[model samples]
Target: MERILMSLQYNGAAYQGFQIQHDLKTVQRELERITQRMHQQFVRIHPASRTDKGVHALEQFIHFDSHLTLPEDKWMHAFNSALPNDIVVTRVNKVDDQFHCRYDTIGKMYRYRVYTNPLRDPLKVNLMTHMPYDLNITDMQKAARLFEGTHDFTSFCSAKTEIDRKVRTIYLSKVIETTYGFDFVIVGDGFLYNMVRIIVNFLTDIAQGFREVDDVHKVIEARDRTKAHKTAPSEGLYLERTFYSEDELKHCVAELNTL
Candidate 1:
């Protein structure tokens, strides 16, 4: 058997999410169906992260063990040919059998976009959030800084989360003004359920003058769900990248070297 790693990019607007669901169309379900058709066998695929409904991905990572003896590079071509227009297998490679996508991912990066114009742009409706009012980008940047470093992000997480630890490191968080609106990029070790969306909502509130900038620190410290703003809509969220440091990748290879 050989383990394969794949990098996928997909528009999430037409699917339920990444995970497989019987009644819904999903990235994973579609990929798995194509894999099974190509190999004529059952396959289980594990993903780096299960993005929520309406959340897109530019470079989602996943892995699976296959007994088929096909060449490594051909997996990309084969999968792409079988996938629909909305989903594409951008890259593929052979990896160690023990390399699980979720466990091996060192960090992930996400971007949330907002359209800050009085007149809504029909073209951007699928890609960005339309905010009719002007947003203060400078204030949003200041608010973004408060989320930097390690902190218990309980307040920013979804109430449905069951994880014991809410603390996660934010390597980078920035709000930059774009031609359309604002772009919020956040890179972190991991995120809690709805964490990014909630953070965006809070920052949006700050930019719109609905909330004070000092409230950012207060919400981080509060660690209470009620203290945070509502979760931002999923349409603006995109999984930008999943990363593994050179050292981490080396370590992973070393551990599987003898296999």
Candidate 2:
């Protein structure tokens, strides 16, 4: 069997989530179905990240073992031919058996798009979260910087999450203003369920004068879920990139800034 890693991009509006569920559409389910059809046998895929419903991905990673002997260059086109229009395989690479998509990931970068316009744009309804109220972008940007270090993000994750540890290190966090909205980028060693969404909500609340600028520090120290703001909508969130090393992450940031 040959092990392969593939990068994918998908619009998450229609699917339940990335994982498989009975009688529901999902990215992994569709991928496996197509792969099984091609291989004429059951196939399993390992995804690097499990994105929530309505959460899109600019670049997602996965690895799978397959007996099919197709050339690496043809895998992307072959997979895209059978996959749904919303999901597409961008790149494929053959790797040693020891390589794992999830375990080998060193960090991940997520971006949240917020529309700050007074009127909602119909074109962007599925992709961007509409926030029609006035906001202090400066304060929000400042608050984002406060999250740029290691902290126990217990207050910023969903209470339903069963994970024992809530500690994660933030490598980078910044909010940049765009023509119609703001883009919040966060790079972290790891994340808890709904962590990014909750952090965005907290920053927005601070910008809207509903919370103090220093509340981020207080909530991190409190480790109380109730101390944080509500989780933001999933549609605005996108898995921008994943990094396998610190150097790769720095290179990605440099490349992204030029775009």
Top candidate, metric lDDT: 2
Candidate 2 lDDT over residue span 1-259, tens digit each = 9998999999999988899989799999989998898889988999999999999998899999988899987898889898989998989999999999999999999999999778889999779999999899999989998998899999999999998998999878888899988999998898899999999999999999999989889999999998884899999999999888789898766664554
Give each model a TM-score: 0.93, 0.96
Whole-model lDDT, model 1 = 0.86
lDDT, candidate 1, at 95: 89
lDDT of each: 0.86, 0.91
Q: Which residue pairs in candidate 2 have backbone atoms (N, alpha carbon, C) closer than 3 angstroms, thus clashing?
A: none
Candidate that scores best on TM-score:
2
Model 2 scores worst on lDDT over the 10 consecutive residues at 250-259
The C-alpha local distance difference test score for the whole of candidate 2 amounts to 0.91
Clashing pairs in 1: none
